[model samples]
Target: MSTSSPEHAIDRMEDRLARLPLRERKKLRTRRAIQDHALRLFAAQGYDETTVEQIAAAAEISPSTFFRYFPTKEDVVITDEYDPIMAEAIREQPAELPPIDALRAMLREILPQLFETDLDALKTRLRITAEVPALRGRTFEGMRATFTVLSEAFAERTGRAPDDPDVEAFSWAVLGVLQAALYRLLDGKTTYEDLPAQIDHNLRFLAQGCPL
Candidate 1:
């Protein structure tokens, strides 16, 4: 797979979550709608001008319910549910598998959920994230958080500190492949159908050997 970063991976996973049962899909869609509404207002009025109450009102969600879903106004844009699921998926992977291979497998395993989400919404989210500075930072922060999760998994597998450079670098490369594909998709240069193989081929080129 093309090397990918955590943001791109999360983006992909969020895409898959769209494939859940109608109830689940509806929940996620509503969540996405709230986020879209929040972002639209934030963009139109400026971050400082926006408030959770405004977002809640715009989303047609109760203020209390908005708090139930997100911690703060800024969180509506960044704190998506898919991040934890990705980490759990990684952790659930057989420990014997190399971390990079585990990530690839995890991506495959998670594909069903990806197919559940709306591609159009994903593209919109990507576009908004690209244009917004706060969103860009939060996206990278989300990536960094995933790196932390991956580091722990790698260390657990290899008996090294999670922060060890080799562990981190290896994790980084796996994410790099996904990011490459995402950049292409976000730019209208590639379609989701073409991404997996494109990412896999690029990843094979990078892996050289060692089984991934």
Candidate 2:
């Protein structure tokens, strides 16, 4: 089983917050509160039916505060607290490892963080993103941003430019594997504990040319 225990994940979050200035930490808390309330509202009602004012009221913040944290309703579903942390973890992988190997290592390291999340909320977010057209576009945009982050990490490790064909290709493949794993996991096709192993297995197949 993955070793990313809930306590450890919470600790990581707390530690991260500890390093931030007080104002920034407050901003993060407000953002998280807004997102949590928004997802709950989206799950209870249809995403299209849930207005920003309702979400803000539920979160005990004004609509203006919601706008300050999330530029639009779609951003609530598309953006996440984990992307930057994941990118940093990817960068922390041993320099001796190949780009794909580094990504594999990073994924393994972060799997337990998944346990720290509210699974139902995640499922709701995914469902909304999958079914809503606007959310779908925003999802793609978010994925593009993630690709850029991973590509830069790969490029830095390999002493290449972010747009270098090799760097871009490798980053896409890694992100693709991650996306596939997440889709399957969120579909309830696999046990939560098996998530990391599933990703690692698929990454291995990817490394092996995805043989038949």
Candidate 3:
């Protein structure tokens, strides 16, 4: 699974989000494609060094088209599709499944897809994300968004506010585990394959609740 695959999952959701109106969906898809292209440029040349015009040219879109999708170069950095897809996944889970269990099930559906893609590109994305402060912040912000989306889904399903302490705690805990695992990977402390298991164990620890 390449890193780009999960991000591509975000692109597909952008396609679906655009569908309330046919024209709007088309716009959303184009914007997402532009963002993807821009990220590629940012990854290739340093984010600060890569100009919007360059990204637009690479994507075969107008510079104005780039501005249309992302107001600033930084905005384009914030486009991760995982939240919407994860929300959709949680929504699809059977009502009877406990919230944590539902999340675990949903992750199973999501993570395999990540690992299934071309590994090299994903590694490149990870490498870029790790090295760039702006990209790293944007990536974490995206993860925070993902956690919020999950918390909202759980709250809706379980009749609790998304911001309920437990929900917030669970959301952050999952995110924290993923961050830790990614850190391990980038730090040369663990293999990519070790991530899911490490994250799973951390989440399990959180789910079981910390003993006082």
TM-score, each model?
0.64, 0.83, 0.75
RMSD in Å for all candidates = 7.4, 2.7, 4.6
Better of 1 and 3 by TM-score: 3
Clashing pairs in 3: 1-115, 1-117, 3-122, 10-81, 18-25
Query: Which predicted model would earn the best TM-score?
Result: 2
Could you tell me the lDDT of residue 171 within candidate 1?
76
> Which scores greater on TM-score, model 2 or model 3?
2
Q: Write the per-residue lDDT of candidate 3 for residues 64-178, one digit (tens) a residue.
A: 9788777777667655445665677778899999887887777776665656542444675677777778777777666766777878998988899998998788778777866
Off by over 4 Å in 1: 1-51, 58-75, 118-120, 209-212
- Model 2 lDDT per residue over 144-192, tens place: 8789888888889999999999889988887788778877865778766
lDDT score at residue 22, model 1, on the 0-100 scale: 65
True lDDT of residue 17, candidate 1: 63
Runs of candidate 3 exceeding 4 Å displacement: 1-28, 75-78, 118-121, 210-212
